[model samples]
Target: MSSFKREFTKLYNDSPANYIKAKRLEKAAELLQASDNRITDIALDCGFNDLANFTKSFRDKYNVTPSNYRLKSR
Candidate 1:
């Protein structure tokens, strides 16, 4: 498992967990930009079980809240 994780990180330039989290956040950002779905729904749809954590992660990555991102995108 350790070897596989190292190789995955080497190939992807990210740890597996971080990669997945980034993908989820990217999806959430896309949804925020392209759809009118509620923030909670988008967070859940992106595989985030907790809305506050999702918002924090989103903010950390994008430097903005989901709602604000949607507003700016549109």
Candidate 2:
């Protein structure tokens, strides 16, 4: 593995929770790329059943709503 992969492996291994959190956030971001989907739909698609929890997590990670992130990315 390269330095980047080794560093990430160490960090991810240090905190399994962070690895899962990152995966969920990544999936949510991908779903948010779809302009047609509502935030609730994206949240569910990202394995988050609670829209409120998803919104909170998304905001904490990106400092904005999923809709806002999509709009700005566009």
lDDT of each: 0.95, 0.81
Per-residue lDDT of model 2, residues 1-74, tens digit only: 67766787787674555677778988889777755788888788778889889888999999998888999878
Clashes of each: 0, 0
| Residue ranges of candidate 1 with Cα displaced over 4 Å | none
Model 1 agreement with the true structure over 1-74: per-residue lDDT tens digits: 69999999999999999999999999999999888889999999999999999999999999999999999999
Please estimate how well model 1 matches the true structure, expressed as its whole-model Cα lDDT. Answer: 0.95
| Residue-pair clashes, model 2 | 0
TM-score of 2: 0.73
Model 2 poorest ten-residue lDDT run: 11-20
Error of 1 at 8 (Å): 0.5
Error of 1 at 1 (Å): 5.7
Q: Please report how far candidate 1 places residue 21 from its true position, in Å.
A: 0.4
